[model samples]
Target: MSSGTASSGAGSDDDHAPWPSPLIRDLVDELRRFNRRKTEFYAESVLEASAFAIMLVLSDGRARTLRELTEELGLEQSTVNRQVNNAIKHGYLERFEVAGSLSRFVRPTDTGREAFHHDGMLRAARIEATFADLAPGTPEGLLRELRAFNQAYDRRVLRETGKDVEATGEHRRYG
Candidate 1:
């Protein structure tokens, strides 16, 4: 949250340094903790953010097929399928066939949803804690900035893998 400017030795009078935002380092560290060498939950470490993201979009709490998950995540069908399979095996998800469709539908079980809810609340609390002393308008400004960042993220995912997936904020799934 340090907004103060610093000048590089490269020497302009301008205080605009070209340092990468600390947010990047912070995020990497946090995610690395989840995948640290000592971690026992390999499945959680491998679970695709996109798959969990797809679950979040299922406001109805009904099952969705890989096709539906892929569309929601703006990801490839195979990627969605693989992640769904992994999730199912982990007991965080279950699959059932649609009445008329050949493809199987996936839904998070109660345990799965509980885990998702826990992660969501933890993240929300962290964000709130991070910005606790900011002014009211600061939160809104940060929200706007985060939205802009996500648009850029979506663009990058599309560029790197031809996917336009998206997610944000309190990280809530359905009710």
Candidate 2:
């Protein structure tokens, strides 16, 4: 038997891999898992994530226009409209027009605000529990790293596809 580190028949390097690196593929996989967990949490809460996002935006007690919400959420206009309509239908939001402005605004109702705060507290507690084993500042560091990685990935996509992927906020299949 060899005394050196034993190889598992296959090497770590994968020049033939489609992705630029294995780490990138792993990162994508982790992000997919994160999103899956988030969706699960929302489902378990008996609320759609989009609706929660709308509630969050309106929870400040300040009226916000649909366009503003769309931009803030980085979601498409149609998606924002649909979520807003749903919220209105559920009586979590009320639409009104400012006297001087042509744009209509949506504000959270008392029920909506209460729900938002309750959900937010629950989510925060869950997150805190999940990270209880981690050292302090680890989550913040990870967030910073993710932000940097996203910026780099955006630049790479722009260079390869000549498209601003971040601006569009759409995932496209790239060769």
Candidate 3:
């Protein structure tokens, strides 16, 4: 048998052949290619990808602790703290104590909220313009699959890191 062909069973057919099927490989490759546009957009937008991602997560006006944000963003605690500190320094975020605990909540300020709205609009326009040529349901289907991919990725991350990120299982609507 060739190295690429598996010898799992005497009667097994190509249907159950082996690891990394063509569909899986193709999906991974396509995701990598699609991610390039995101990287390029962030590069041209003058905001670091990390910062932008952080802002997007916080755009819902729901205050999240540093640890919560770190796990959600899948970034190191120190990195998230640094970004939080930077946001605070720039007046984009405010950190307040949780009354009786040392834990603090980082919430966006009015200016930060405005920034989020502006960024959301810019991103929506960019995506709309880019996918305007696609069929009517294509973009919606892609968004649904992307959300599923994100959940799977988060699950894998939790298994590897021992940190659980709460999955809302629902997409946040942005206007």
Candidate 4:
């Protein structure tokens, strides 16, 4: 948690010095490790991570346009398009247009819903087992803290970039 900066060179100014806080370094390392472990777990699942994410978002049975999905997932249009196309090819998803709308919306097929449920149960079991080994209330506390930290981080990013979350429609989509 050290706030004192460490100099990279003898004459380096404090304003230009990189943050050498142990807390920041540890946070980065732990995040990377968590991501790696999560990736490894998903590698054994039937659906790819992107597909699973899309399915999860569509799990409420509501169809969403590609633009909506891209914005919700915070991914580039090309990436979401590629993933959606792959899911459609696999029969897990389908695209349809509303009667008067030019935009095509994507939704999960029956197979996709079944697969998503199956994978979700598996993931839940794994998480529950892991949580069982932790101290009581630890998981809940961690989740609360993580959510708070993410909100703060997002707010800071928006403020620094002079971007309005509402104007971007992110607050409406996620808030």
Cα lDDT tens digits, model 4, 1-175, are: 2224432344434433244644455566566666665445554477777888898778766799999898877789999999999999998999998999999999999888888888887887787888888667566787778778776877887989977654443443221
Highest-scoring model, TM-score: 4
Deviation in Å, model 3, residue 43 alpha carbon: 7.8
Off by over 4 Å in 4: 1-18, 42-44, 166-175
Order the candidates by TM-score, highest first. 4, 3, 2, 1
Clashes of 1: 0
What does candidate 3's lDDT look like per residue over 23-111, in tens digits? 45445556666677544554335344555677788877688888878777767999999988887787778988877777899888877
Residue 1 lDDT in candidate 4:
23
For all candidates in order, the CA lDDT equals 0.59, 0.69, 0.67, 0.75
Candidate 3: worst 10 consecutive residues by lDDT?
Answer: 1-10
Error of 1 at 74 (Å): 1.9
For model 2, how does the per-residue alpha-carbon lDDT over 6-89 read when each residue is reduced to its tens digit?
234465576326656655555556677666764456434634677787776555556888887887677899989998999788
Ranking by lDDT: 4, 2, 3, 1
Per-residue CA lDDT of model 1 for 1-175, tens digit only, reads 2332322334443323342544444455554554452223324333346445655665466677777677765568888778778777777788877678888778888777876676556555655786886566466786677567656766787679864254322223222
How does model 2 fare in lDDT?
0.69
